[model samples]
Target chain A: GAGVSQSPRYKVAKRGQDVALRCDPISGHVSLFWYQQALGQGPEFLTYFQNEAQLDKSGLPSDRFFAERPEGSVSTLKIQRTQQEDSAVYLCASSSQAFSYNEQFFGPGTRLTVL
Target chain B: TQLLEQSPQFLSIQEGENLTVYCNSSSVFSSLQWYRQEPGEGPVLLVTVVTGGEVKKLKRLTFQFGDARKDSSLHITAAQPGDTGLYLCAGGRSGGYNKLIFGAGTRLAVHP
Candidate 1:
């Protein structure tokens, strides 16, 4: 079975530009999550989706960050007016069920570098 | 905010040596998971411990959950070069949207 997958393995963007990172979750996965990983640090939660409904997004650092999982399968995390601080690896994960106890399958991640 | 603190942020050991990484938190969790990530790759789940005082072993790797469910540990016996990577421990609270709080991670480098 295919695991979660993210596009644009690496992206270099100028500050103030907008970037959208895409995620393809495994088929029939009911839970999806987004996380931000800074260098030398563990991944920080960003948002979550159960099907097409976004269940929680309190972890999003700022208003500049937004995400959507419309249609309940594919998701996207978009950053508006990117800042140098936004540079990090954006990871997407999915689990078969909506329960938090289930193990999440993670994607390779898209490294965004704001220059 | 629930924070998971991992000790020994960085570790370098020779192959065949044993090592242990610890994750501690002030808040209790319903479940804890250990993940291993190599360079340029997303973290791969290693083990999940839900019961207090629980121990699960994967080959030479052993995982333990604290009796209080507030801490966990991973011990590798006879480490190999393939064991080298960032080890992360994540805690999931009992309720909410199933958000996971992750530790800063311990970077392990095993030299053969």
Candidate 2:
């Protein structure tokens, strides 16, 4: 794909169920990030990955939230035992640099609805 | 706590009018970026300001960063219907891993 892409544009999960969202960043991009956004609000940072190594997970809300980028190109965010408050749009973004001013390109985002 | 705050959460204006959106923060950032997002898509980068007290213009849009690198303002001149969308401001820290701290955002509706 020419830009970042996310799978399952919309997902509905019952409370206490687990869900995994996938992201495919631009080819060869080094930095990947995950964010959660509520309706009519801005994105909140979740985690960050540089290549295949997870560098920052400070923004993850709880121990149930997990993310990984095994190959540096594709990434996944897993939420275990979801709650009602967990409903939000999960966004993925990638940049060409690790910690620079390079522009971060974003994906369409996966809207997760917890029922 | 929200590190950055945006004012006028919702804006509705007529075409050809001008408006300004503000993003304020207490902490400093290495660089600030502006992005526009549609209803069903991702945010697209508009511009980035690296230096404090810097100003950048994109066509009818003008962006300014505060001298302390703690705030930013976006000014749109002669807005059109095409300018309607959610506008976001994100900041990157110098020693961080390029993780963006974002404001709540300002949703602008330019009606023709």
Candidate 3:
């Protein structure tokens, strides 16, 4: 069985540039989550999706962050006018069910550096 | 805001030694989960403790949930070098689509 996968293992961008990170959740997974992890820190929740519907976006830090899962299986996180503070590893995780009680499978994550 | 605090931010020990990592919070949670993450990789789920005072074991690792469901601990017996990684604790609330609140994490280094 395949686990969650994120693309562009590493990315470097100018401070004002926009960047998009993609995530492919495990097949048949109904719940997907996005988290941002700073260096030497724990991952912070960004958003969550149940199928194609975005259920939670309160964790997103600011209006610059946007995420969508239109097809219900794949998701993309876009950051506009990236800031130096936005530098961190973007992690994607998915679970078989929509409940948090279910164990989540995580992807390697995309490390983004804003200079 | 629900916040999880992990103690002993960093640990270094020789192989075969025993170690424990703690996660604490003032807020009660519906469930708590432990994860181990290696460099250049995402975290892998280790165990989930749902009941108050519940304990679960996985080989050399033992996980315990606090009686009030506000804390958790992970103990490793005779740890090996392979056990080295960043240990993270996450708490799940009763509602809100199962969003998780995570701790800063403890980085463990086990030298063989």
Model 1, range A1-115, lDDT digits (tens) per residue? 4888899899999999999999999999999999999999999999999999998999899999999988999999999999999999999999998876888999999999999
**TM-scores of the candidates, chain A only:** 0.98, 0.97, 0.98
Docking tier of model 3: it is: medium
Best by DockQ: 2
Candidate 3: true interface contacts recovered: 0.76
What is the overall TM-score of model 3 with all chains considered together?
0.98
- Candidate 3 residue B9 Cα shift, in angstroms, is 0.5
Q: State the lDDT of candidate 2 residue by residue for B1-112, as single tens digits.
A: 7898998899999999999999999999999999999998999999999899999999999999999999999999999999999999999888756778899999999999
| DockQ category of candidate 1 | medium
Each model's lDDT comes to 0.94, 0.94, 0.94
| TM-score list, all predictions | 0.97, 0.98, 0.98
- Residue B68 lDDT in model 1? 98
Which consecutive 10 residues in model 2 chain A have the weakest lDDT in total? A95-104
Q: Could you give candidate 1's per-residue lDDT for residues B58-84 as a string of tens digits?
A: 999999999999999999999999999
Looking at model 3 chain A, report the run of 10 residues with the lowest lDDT sum: A95-104
